[model samples]
Target: MRLKKRISPHSLRHSYATHCIEAGVNLADLQHFLGHQSILTTTRYTHLTQSNTDSAIVRINALMDSIHVDWGNVK
Candidate 1:
């Protein structure tokens, strides 16, 4: 009787690592949590996290609004 499925455990572990990265957890912390021998292994999960594009856009907009530059007369 086969009690376990044929799915590979590596895939599940990859999913878990990716989820942790996306949740704002640091790579070092995740590395420890995943029991990886090297931090480089944990870094592979960084690609799963957002590229901070939203945060960068928000900051850029805020800066544009806050700046008081007079572009009309200034050369």
Candidate 2:
């Protein structure tokens, strides 16, 4: 298979973690799924992809846009 050269047994776990993080799975929960004793270890396993970063920026902008700030009312 074309993937035989690119994939290994250990790499599967890494890929699983990446996909889960990208899918919005909680880090603590993913830590449990991976049987990691420390959240630090889980953090090491997950990575933020471009899509995730973009989605976060969009969410933040949406939240900011929804807020009604009255500069005149500020004391």
Candidate 2 clashing pairs, residues 3+ apart or interchain? none
What are the per-residue Cα lDDT tens digits for candidate 1 across 1-75? Answer: 875766668768877877776566788889999888999988875563345567567789998788675866432
lDDT of 2: 0.88
Overall lDDT per candidate, in order of appearance: 0.74, 0.88
**TM-score, cand. 2:** 0.80
How does candidate 1 score on lDDT?
0.74
User: How well is each residue in 1-75 modelled by candidate 2, as lDDT tens digits?
Assistant: 255467787789988999999988999999999999999998887777898899999999998888776986632
Total clashing pairs in model 2: 0
- Regions more than 4 Å wrong, model 1: 1-6, 49-75
Winner by lDDT: 2
